[model samples]
Target: MNVMKRIAQSALKKTLIVAMATGAMFSTQAFAAEKVYRLKLAETWGANFPIFGDATKNMAKMANEMSNGRLEIRIDSANKHKAPLGVFDMVKSGQYDMGHSGSYYWKGKVPNTLYFTSMPFGMLPAEQYAWFYYGGGMDLMNQVYSPHNLLSFPGGNTEFQMGGWFQKEINSVDDLKGLKMRIPGFAGEIMAELGAKPTNIAPGELYTALERRTIDALEWVGPSLDLRMGFHKIAPYYYTGWHEPGSELQFLVNKQVWEKLPADLQEILRISMKTAAYDMYIQAVHESGKNWASIKTEYPNVKVKDFPPEVMDALRAANDKLLKEHASQDPLAKEIQASQAAYLKEVRAWTDISTKAYLDNEAK
Candidate 1:
């Protein structure tokens, strides 16, 4: 009976040990399931930049949902947490985990970065999206950012933009001289070359600057955003198709932070950006059409004019010269331009046959 009691006692001890181990395992799994991370995201534009705000909020929302609340992002607009132009470096240095801004904002740091934003007389929004996603443009962009300890993904895009809102008419190249213009990136440089003083100002400050006559001209996104900002009220002479042909925005992540993310999460970010990029482009195109109509009806005094053919020709020539000068100064600039030109050749062929043909017929 004692021996039987001893065996029973031993069995009971073994059972307790197993139960304890199982409990410990369950506790660890539960702890891991509750793990949470918070990331800081920044953008150059204010909350009013529709695509920037919308895409960013969408990304944060999707990430939270997918992660089951394990990951949360806190977004801060320009000067909310950092300066607008400082975003790229902040993300690169891990001061901020992520940023959403125009690639052109960092032209001083990376001259080739402007290609990701827009190239003068370059591809439109749809074509830019195709080039970046499918034509290996993103890979080339990564190459440019790699040295800076950054990883960039294409974010929202602003489709074809208006030439600008000018206080005075630009009938010829000579008219651009000595004009204090608020522009950015290669466009700004081209303006300076053409004798305009190109100044960089945040979107939020644009309206007041134009109102106070601090700037002679301003080029914001398009009619929709411009109308909302009341640019037409100040500069009634609106020109089309000169400065920014197509503008693309970007999502930049710190290389270290990006590398640390789970493979699946990294892919989720890329896919989300890719989807948002195209969606935002379409949204802008649709909104611009509606906004143009609204502008004509609401603001009868605003003069809407197509850029004269001579003006367009001169600007195009200046753009080409500016690009050549940039390529000469920066090897990366040359590389990006080469890639873009090559990809555009292929894209133009197909687009000319299909999309352009359809548009031309519709115009007639």
Candidate 2:
């Protein structure tokens, strides 16, 4: 009886140990499966900025749904969480997980960032997307951002942009002198070289500035945005086909946060960004077509003119000089330009045969 009791006690001890171990294993699995991550996204434009604003919302929604609610993003526009320029540093330091804005805004911090924005007479929207996604432009962009502990994705393009809105007719390059223009990126530099002073103003402040005559000329974006912002009421001389040929917007992610995402999540991000890029470009073109028609109807006094041949020639020459200077000073700029030019040469052939031909035929 004594031996039997002892055996029974030993059996009870072993069973208790087994039960505890099983419970711990189940708890560990539950904790791992319940893991969730939140990302804070910042954009330079306000919530009403149309293409960019809509794209940001769409991206966040897609990410959440595709992740099955495991990865969530909360987006804030300018002054919502941080200032526009502060976005780069905030994401770099992991204060925020992502940023959506123009690369031109950060040219002071990373001069090569301008390449990601737009080059004067550069690739058009479709070509730009091709170069970035398939022609190694994205890899070069990531290389430029790698030093700052960030990763960049080409989010969208603004297609071919208008020259700008001016208070007076720019019949010659001389008319540009002393003109206070609100342009950014390489376009601003080119403007400075042409004897104009380029000023940086946020979109919300643009209408008031133009109305008050604080600035003589302004280049916000294409017709859709310009019409929406009421630039037609302020500036009578609307010019086309100079400065920004194609404006590209970017999605910047913190390096650490990007590295932490699961492989499946990363794939989701890449696919979603590609989709947003194509969708936003299509939307811009569609809206601009409607807006141009409306602008002609509503603003009869607004003189829509193309830049003179001499002015366009001068601007293009100046742009080439600026590109050379940038490349000489910054190795990364040199690499990016080389990559862009090479890819563009390949893509332009097909574009010339297709889009260029179609437009030329339509013009006649």
Candidate 3:
């Protein structure tokens, strides 16, 4: 009987060992099944483009570190993709899993997109950020992007854009007549309304265009980005901005690809993008101050001017007319415009009191 009991005990031990080994194998398989997801991102900037490219790189790095190898993102700049303006279409069709480009660039393809970027005389950066996060801008953005099978997020801010680098000063509204400028989006429409010939040129070709008088003026970001373009050397007049008060770049994600990410990884990506966007804004501010100081010190010949009161009035009138035309055509456009107008009114008051007031007081 004792011998029988020993044999039974041995059989039980072997059964338990088999069960434990099988469980371990299944656990390993489960872990393996959650393999690293690789995604491709296309950007609208050339390779090694300064602040814009850095934003994407930083986002990818953060995502990778947070996911602990579960997610990987590869970025292809305009140099690699050779489709700077086609980022929207490529991401929509899933040819690229993500994209970094200006949302306003899609105005021709998606009219509502214009509202999400900076409008002519729009809210400043802080106010716009508040509107985006707290004032229903994100929901409106999602509504606009959802039909395209893409998700949109604020990629970064260019702070307050410098008006443009001009060969001649804009002294009056008459000076805008027949002026050839390379500007894009709604601002270009506003320029055209004011009788300026607005053209769109690739960033890589902007300097050559300006130098050769192919375009008389161009607005590229601010000192943060424009300094590197060497525009200060060719275009002697630097105008203060009235358009694109706070330009925001966008991140485009293929909805299908975004959906495929695990819950944890999705959170990681969202946080990564948000953090990177904020970081880019801060970096841009730092670079702008540094580069503007350099430009003033090194290129003292560059004249800084603001649009005259008459020119400002004409531009504002044109902007109002065009916005009205847009609103009249599409209900969604009207809704967005109304939202922006309301938000801007509410926020600009505080900005005037808080920011403008301080500056005015300090200057005095």
Candidate 4:
């Protein structure tokens, strides 16, 4: 009986040893796999620059939380980086692991970047979002950026951007001629085609430039952001927008940095950016409504005007001519133009049937 008892005790001890060894192995593996990844991001906006800046902050927070502290992103705004237009180059060169800026800002470096932002007479915010996620826009955008060793994603949306706050009204197409306006990106190019002299001014100097008559007109953003800039005080004529109907800011990530992240972290980053973008769009809509109401009530002197049909026709023709020139110059540009045109036709039909029809009914 004593011998049998000793055998049972010895077998139990061996089983316990194996279980302990197996658990220790897993513990070691788990510890090694849990190493934190730290990345630095650079943004084109100044520190604390409203909706644009909030997007980066929101993205970083979501990524960190979702990754359970495995991912940490440090952001440097334009003030720290001192290169508002250099975000694309910085992320591509790996000076920054990521960047937050408008893709159109890099149009000078890569003309294809212009297509990812809002186009003149293009889709609205909802339609644009549908194109981005469903209508091959993401795939095309990747094709444009892959060569640069960078990945681009939508950072945020500014909704429908307002036309320039003009010191005087635009009653005719001829009024655009020789007008010096503070505009940028593809819209500025469009303006230049209409015989307007478009100048790029820093946001910090925009108010002073307009106030001092350094610029005849300027367009910042819609009521959502423009009220804070105080453009209404100086420019009484606030024209409706046609240039940037749904401007989307972008997030640029170094390809190498993205590849280095684990698949889970990569997904976390992607989802976080997408969420932040949609959130900004919703916020922009709410803010626009609230701010415009306040402006109408408090500032009775402000006049809102839409460009006359003749002016619109001229601008549209000019826009088409420039687009044709671009398509003639580059095959990729031609492809992008065709894709957006086709997608817009299909989507706008449904939009007209749904949103437009409903709104028209409500007007009655």
Which candidate should be chosen as best, given TM-score against the real structure? Answer: 3
Write down the lDDT of every candidate, Cα atoms only: 0.82, 0.82, 0.90, 0.90
What candidate 3 gets wrong by more than 4 Å, as runs, is: 1-29, 32-34
Q: Give the least accurate 10-residue stretch of model 1, judged by summed lDDT.
A: 24-33
Give a tens-digit lDDT track for model 3, residues 102-152: 998988899899888798988888889899999999999999999999999
Positional deviation of residue 270's Cα in model 1 after best superposition, in angstroms: 2.2
Q: Please estimate how well model 4 matches the true structure, expressed as its whole-model Cα lDDT.
A: 0.90
TM-score for all models, in order of appearance:
0.90, 0.90, 0.92, 0.91
lDDT, model 2: 0.82
Comparing 1 and 4 by lDDT, which wins? 4
For 116-195, candidate 1 gives per-residue lDDT tens digits of 88877788777887888798898989898999998888887788888889999888888889999999988888888888
lDDT of 4 by residue, 299-352 (tens): 888999999999999889988999999999999999999999999999999999
RMSD of each: 8.4, 9.0, 8.2, 8.2
Question: Which of the two, 3 or 4, has more TM-score?
Answer: 3
Sort the predicted structures by TM-score, highest score first. Answer: 3, 4, 2, 1
The list of candidate 2 runs beyond 4 A from truth reads 1-24, 27-30
